[model samples]
Target: MGVRRVAKGVGDLLIETLGEAVAEVILNLVACALLGCLALIACLCWSFSPRLTIAGAGLFSCLLAHGAWHTVRNPPKGRRRGLAALTAVAFTSTAMTALFLLLYATGCDCL
Candidate 1:
C-alpha cells in the first residue's frame, strides 16, 4: 500500500509540472502573436509615408538583428530550440511595431 501511494504521488507531481509547462508555452505563444499583429500594422502605416516607412524599416531591422542574436546565443538542445526561436521572432516583430507607432506619433520628418 505504501509503494502504491508513493507511485501515485510521483505521478501527480509529474502531471502538475507538465500542466504548468504547457500553460507557460500557451502564454508565450499568445504574446508572440499579438506582437506580430502590431508589427504588421506598423508596416502598413509606413506605406503611406516614406519617412515614416524608413523609420519603420529601421525598427524592423533592429528587431531582426536582435532575434538573430538571440537564436545564435542560445543553441537549442531539442524541441525547446524551436520555441525559443518563435519567442525571439515574436519579440522582434512587436518591437518594430512599437517603434513605427512612435515615429508616426512623434511627427519627425527626417529619418
Candidate 2:
C-alpha cells in the first residue's frame, strides 16, 4: 500500500511538471508569432503611413524588451539557444527601425 501511494504521488508530480512545461512552450510560441506578425505589419505600413509604422515598431520593441527581461530573470532551462536567436533578431530589427527613422528625418526621396 505504501509503495502504491508513492507511485501515485510520483505520477502526479510528473504530470504536473509536464503540464507546466507545455504551457510555457505554448506561451513562448504565441509570443514569437505575435512579434513576427507585428514586424511584418509594420514593414508593410512603412510605405503607407509613417505614424502607423512607428506605432507598430514601438509596440514591437516594448514586447521584445519585456520578453527579454522575463527570460533573463528566470533563465529557463534549454532556452539558451532561443535567447541567442532572439537577441540576433532584436539587433536587426532595431537597426532597421533606426534606418527608417533616419531616412524619414532626412526626407529621403527614396522612401
Candidate 3:
C-alpha cells in the first residue's frame, strides 16, 4: 500500500507538470502570433500596415499554410516531416510574440 501510494503520487506529479508544459507550448504558439500582430500594429501603424496581421498569424494559420506548402512542394514519401518541423518552429516564434504582447497589454514591464 505504501509503495503504491508513492508511485501514484509520482505519476500524478509527472503527468501534471508534463501536461502543463505541453499546454504552455501550444498556447505560447497562439499567443506569439497574437502578440506579433499587436507589436506590428504599434510599430507600423494601421495606415502603414495592411494584410500583415493576416499574414503574421504565424502560430496557427501560418503553420498550417507552411505545412501544406512544404508537403506539396516536396511530396513526402510517407509524410511531410519538414512541414511539421517548420510549423513547430514557427509556432514557438509566434508564442514569443504572444508573450510579449501579453506583457505589453498588462503594462507589467513598468511594474
**lDDT of model 1, residue 14:** 100
Off by over 4 Å in 2: 51-111
Candidate lDDT (C-alpha), each: 0.67, 0.66, 0.63
**Against the hidden reference, what TM-scores do the models get?**
0.42, 0.46, 0.38
Assess candidate 1 and give its lDDT.
Answer: 0.67
Give the Å error, residue 67, model 2.
23
Best-to-worst order by TM-score is 2, 1, 3
On TM-score, the leading prediction is 2
Q: Which regions of candidate 3 are displaced past 4 Å?
A: 40-100, 103-111
**Residue pair clashes in candidate 1:** none
Give residue 43's lDDT in candidate 1 (0 to 100): 75
Residue 94's lDDT within candidate 2 is: 64
Task: Give the per-residue Cα lDDT of candidate 2 at 59.
Answer: 77
- Worst lDDT window (10 residues) for model 3? 102-111
Candidate number that wins on lDDT, 1 or 2: 1
User: Which candidate wins on lDDT?
Assistant: 1
C-alpha root-mean-square deviation, each candidate: 14.1, 16.0, 9.3
